[model samples]
Target: MTGSLTAARAMAAAAARLRAAGVADPARDARLLLAHAARIDAARVTLIAPEELSPEIAERYEQLVSLRAIRVPVSHLTGEREFYGRRFKISGEVLDPRPETETLIEAALSEPFARVLDLGVGSGCILVTLLAERAQATGLGVDISEAACLQASANAVLHGVAERAEIRRSDWLSDVAGRFDLIVSNPPYIALDEMAGLDEEVRRHEPELALTDGGDGLGAYRRIADGVMRHLAPGGRLLVEIGPTQVAAVIALFAQAGLVDIGIVQDLDGRDRVIRARRG
Candidate 1:
């Protein structure tokens, strides 16, 4: 780390440091951070493994590793996260897009809709991905946090869907108007009691508003359900990402809202991940 260090050696040292600090997948993170420091793609890290690190790149890598050892998420360090085959700019102001949410995306693209509404659009991954996948579609994405709204907007612009996507700050459906053929949300469903059980990266770095509803975790769903019928077109669809243990609770909420065809979709891990329902 002091002088004339090769990329491989530096990464090996960094990985050991991360491992000692309890970072899961230390080697992978080491490789990725090295690539970031060197201004190269992660895949190219191996090509430069034998080459000596520039003083500047070595210094940069040290700073990044230091942050990672403290459990700052890799996506936050890289300033972006890949979701649904696209990368979205991310920050501590918003929740990092997760792979489990792709279950909702698949369910969304399974049907056709010209209009969509994304509630609690943390990073706009759901709405933006849908619009990107369906070029003819236009959408509105709302979040209670202005910072989240800004993050979502940046992602919409990054994916070339800003022209078709509108990002706004609203508490659930309060400021939203007009009926849409589709509505989706990956709202804050974590219960307050469960907050302490989260990983350091999530518990410390991600926005709390984007992670928990400050209650039993059903608060956002309740708000969404109360107003959904008024905003949904008849026979329109509503899709939401949910915790694995939330299937019964969410189904009951949706059913009470008079949504029909309520069903569950599991993620790659076979856990109940999304609930899809249609307006009656």
Candidate 2:
């Protein structure tokens, strides 16, 4: 059915389908899908808008558009997401790296670190980005999901950090050894009750283990803060990404753990997004 449609028309129709499905950014999603369908850059889609799609690409585009109509994440459909100015391969197995997480990355880079550890290292985006930027830094990333560890390993190789980055299957830091100068995490902070109310794309498509702790949202933070004191070298820093409303509770956990110089960093939106602390 799509073979008979011009590129521009195909995009318009796809946008309509997405809009009808209640997608927030139907036009942008449509453009990205069209570019993906044609196997070309999204920026070039406009140049080819007047052209007709080959039968094969057209059918694939139609199928992807249909999937999007059901609220499947675009990154999952495309199999990639850009984070921290680098492309990270993505899947339903790992959290799709978001631009807001870059706030954590920027804060991490603000200080010099020769070694790093990433807890709950889904897709290895945080670890790999740090290794790539610091060049001399070697890091370890651990995740509870073996599938996530595998995906993160692949991403490490993809980004040319395989030699410096190690991926492991572990619950938080249970299998981790030795202390490090920097430790970072983007642990699940969504309470069990909040999971059901998330957007369909997140609730249905993202892994539940990475989105919630099956109890209060603060469980992961408590665990992280408790276990971190022993693993953090004296003067080492720990940075964690938190839900917008979790700033106070998370800071309290850090204080109870005897961490000092604790502070919060806000995302560009001005909501508290990262909590930073130093081991005494």
Candidate 3:
């Protein structure tokens, strides 16, 4: 840092700092941060790996590395995340899309629907991806944050689904009208007590509104159970992403709300990650 440093040297130093900070994947993160700072593809980092970094790039790289060392998510630092075979823009205002959520997407797409509703849409990854996959399908995505709505809208445009997708600021389905043939949500399920134990990147950098419902982790599920029956058309399907351990509680809430045909889907890790239900 004091003297001129090559890309390889800088990457090594950054990785060392991240390791000391308890980052789980220090070396890989170091290369990714460097790639963003250098405005180069990660695959091409090796070409510059042995080359000296320009002063400006070096400074920016160091700043990004520092942020990453402090537990900022790489997706947030880069402002992009890949989900459902597409790249989505991300920010502190929305939850970063995770691969586990793809289980919900897979489950939703397993059935057919002309209209879809996404609750707590965040960056609109679910609605957008679904709309993209089913070109004729239309979708409405709702979130409580105006910023999240805006971000979701932008993502819809990015994926060329803006014409068929609508992003709105709402808590669940409060202001939504009409019934959707299919509805999905990846709501906040982390209990208030469990929040303190979240990874530093999630606890410190991600939006809390998208992370917890401020009481029981099941609060969002409860709210959804109350509203989904009214919003879903007869014989419609509903799928929700859930924490690995929330299967029983969520299924009970849905069943109590009169939802039937309820089932569970597992992620690749073999953990229960999505709950599937249907309204008669």
Candidate 4:
């Protein structure tokens, strides 16, 4: 927070700064930042419309704005992001789940999976959401980042599914034991060379490991295809989120892994964002 907007005048002034700085939703962002600083919801801020915030809260709010001005994502500034229409806790340690990835969750949910595995799980959003939606299912969310595993585990508990969800640090399926009816992942798929062209917020705030596939952006797909069958039960299905342009390449990778009945699913925008295959 730069500081809180203590009064109507202060909020108006802050709004002007945000607008000048090209924040698309300046008023909404300012209100959101202020509400966070005050430890109150935006609805509550409206209730106290005529009042001035305490000095401490004002200062905090300003700091949030200052960070946002530097291109940090609003989700990061707020430490929360909405995925599959549910809120999840997130930080620099994990990838921020996006709406498009929800398509993968929905595809998996279309089947009544008894056991599920989420590789490269970050923030526990996918696995937790799966267990929550399919009450009879148990899940494991595996990630290389221990910090991310901890955060994801916390989210599982928060959503009342910790007992059914195990968040463990593993490089894909390596060092993990599992045979799941379903598997899914929203792994890092951006090529390192393309990172420089990403949006300011993504490049400036999101973790590079979670954004880039290290070099070709196809590395994650290779790793997943190589390891997926090792932990996938025969007849199980795997659903993975892929970049728009990566649909064909990842499909080929899955084929090389002996997966069959392969198919791609598109997002709302009609981009091929998910690849679903059955383990042979």
What candidate 1 gets wrong by more than 4 Å, as runs, is none
Per-residue alpha-carbon lDDT of candidate 1 for residues 1-280, written as tens digits (9 for 90 to 100): 8449999999999999999999999999999999988999999999999999999999999999999999999999999888988989999898899999999999999989999999999888889999999999999999989999999999999999999999998989999999999999999999999999998779999899988999999998999899999989998999999976788999999999899999999899999899999998
Ranking by TM-score: 1, 2, 3, 4
Q: Number of clashes in every candidate structure?
A: 0, 0, 0, 13
TM-score of structure candidate 2? 0.97
Report, for every candidate in turn, its global Cα lDDT versus the true structure: 0.93, 0.92, 0.91, 0.85
- Highest lDDT scorer: 1
- Per-residue lDDT over 51-126 for candidate 3, one digit per residue giving the tens place of the 0 to 100 score: 8899999989989988887798999899999898898999999999999898888888898899999999899999
Question: In terms of lDDT, which candidate is stronger, 2 or 4?
Answer: 2
The estimated TM-scores of all candidates read: 0.98, 0.97, 0.95, 0.92
Better of 1 and 4 by lDDT: 1
> At residue 141, what lDDT does model 3 achieve?
95
- The stretch of ten residues in a row with the least summed lDDT in candidate 2 is 1-10
- Per residue, candidate 4 scores C-alpha lDDT tens digits across 132-175 of 99999998888988889898988998899999998888888787
Candidate 4 regions exceeding 4 Å error are: 1-12
